[model samples]
Target: MGVLTGKTALVTGASRGIGRGVAERLGRDGPRIAVHYGSDKTAAKETVAAIEAAGGSAFAIGVRLGMPGDADRLWEEFDRHADGLDILVHNAGIGTSRPFAEIGEEEFDRLFAVNVKAPFFLTRLGAERLRDGGRVVNISSGLARAAAMPQLIAYAMTKAALDVFTRDLSKELGPRGITVNSVAPGIVDTDVNAAWLRASEEAWQEAAALAALGRVGTPADIADVVAFLVSEDGRWVTGHWLDATGGSLT
Candidate 1:
């Protein structure tokens, strides 16, 4: 049996990119995964199929975030499937690379609403259903600590806020043996960045050069780090922001 054979995990935004990778990885460990998707039901089903093909269990849950009743709606859907949660992976987020001066109020509010507010309320309500010794892993970005991309200022701010939430939540949930952490990744080659990173050879090379490892990162690279965090081996680690940045921040 896998380490998480009887556990349940909820991974938001599992329809694609890093979230998809996390969902699949955790599924491999035997957790009954709740694959949450914002609007892509087909992609979510594919994620669930992939897990099942690997001898894992998973089900899809769809709910649009950044709205008033997002968290509540998600939990209501979740209630139909499982009673308790062992892992909560907040991987759903939106990004913007517009220069600080050009960004409008509507854009900034939407960024915070989806990226920060959604996760905050999701955890607040989900925490009651999260069992003791459960895991809460927030998929943060290296920009939270590094000012490498000035154009992504607003996106960076949201991640920084998430990191703070991880730290404070860890302390608050420590007594229950729950662990909260933020995993920061740098220049991951996901659909989110494909437009720019894969647009030209020079762009790709420049992005690769940022990582000390001599290549851009992949979803699986971040997923492996997350897998370790939620496993029994990571029991003693909490309230920390892990740099899964391939030495970019170093």
Candidate 2:
């Protein structure tokens, strides 16, 4: 049996990218995975299929976050599949590529709504369903700690807020043995970054050089870190911000 054979994990935005990676990894570890998606039901189905094909079980749930009553809708759907949660990976988020001066109010508000607010209320409302000794991980960005991408100023702010949430929530959930942490990645080569990162050799190499490891990160790299964090080996770790950036911030 796998380490997490009886556990249930909810990975938000698991339809693609890092979220999908985490879902698949956790599912392999033997958890029943709830693959949550925003609107891409087709993609979500594929994610579930991939997990099942890999000898893991998973189901897909659709709920657009960052809206009023969104958290309520999400949990309601989750209730249809599982009784409780052992892992919560908050990976759903939106970003703005415009510079700070060009970022409009709506864009800023939307960033906070999806990236910061959604997870905040989701955890608060899902507390009852979150089992004692559960794990919570927020997928953060290296931009939250560095000014490497000033164009994503608003987006960086949202991640910074999420890190703060992780720190404080760890304390609040400590009594129940729940661990909360922020996993910050840098220049991961996911679909989201494929267009730009693959545009040219120079673009790719420049991104790779940012990390001391001299290679661009992949979804699997981030996923492995998350797997460690949610496992029994990570029991004593809580309220920490781990740089899964391959030494990019060094």
- CA lDDT of each candidate? 0.96, 0.95
Candidate 1 Cα lDDT to native: 0.96
- Model 2 — TM-score against the truth? 0.99
- Candidate 2: the clashing residue pairs are none
What's the residue-level lDDT of 196 in candidate 1?
A: 93
TM-score of every model? 0.99, 0.99
Model 2 gets an lDDT of 0.95
Give candidate 1 regions above 4 Å deviation: none
* lDDT digits (tens) for residues 148-239 of candidate 1: 67799999999999999999999999999999999999999999899999999999999999889989999999999999999999999999
After best superposition, candidate 2 residue 174: deviation in angstroms?
A: 0.3
lDDT value, residue 104 of candidate 1: 95
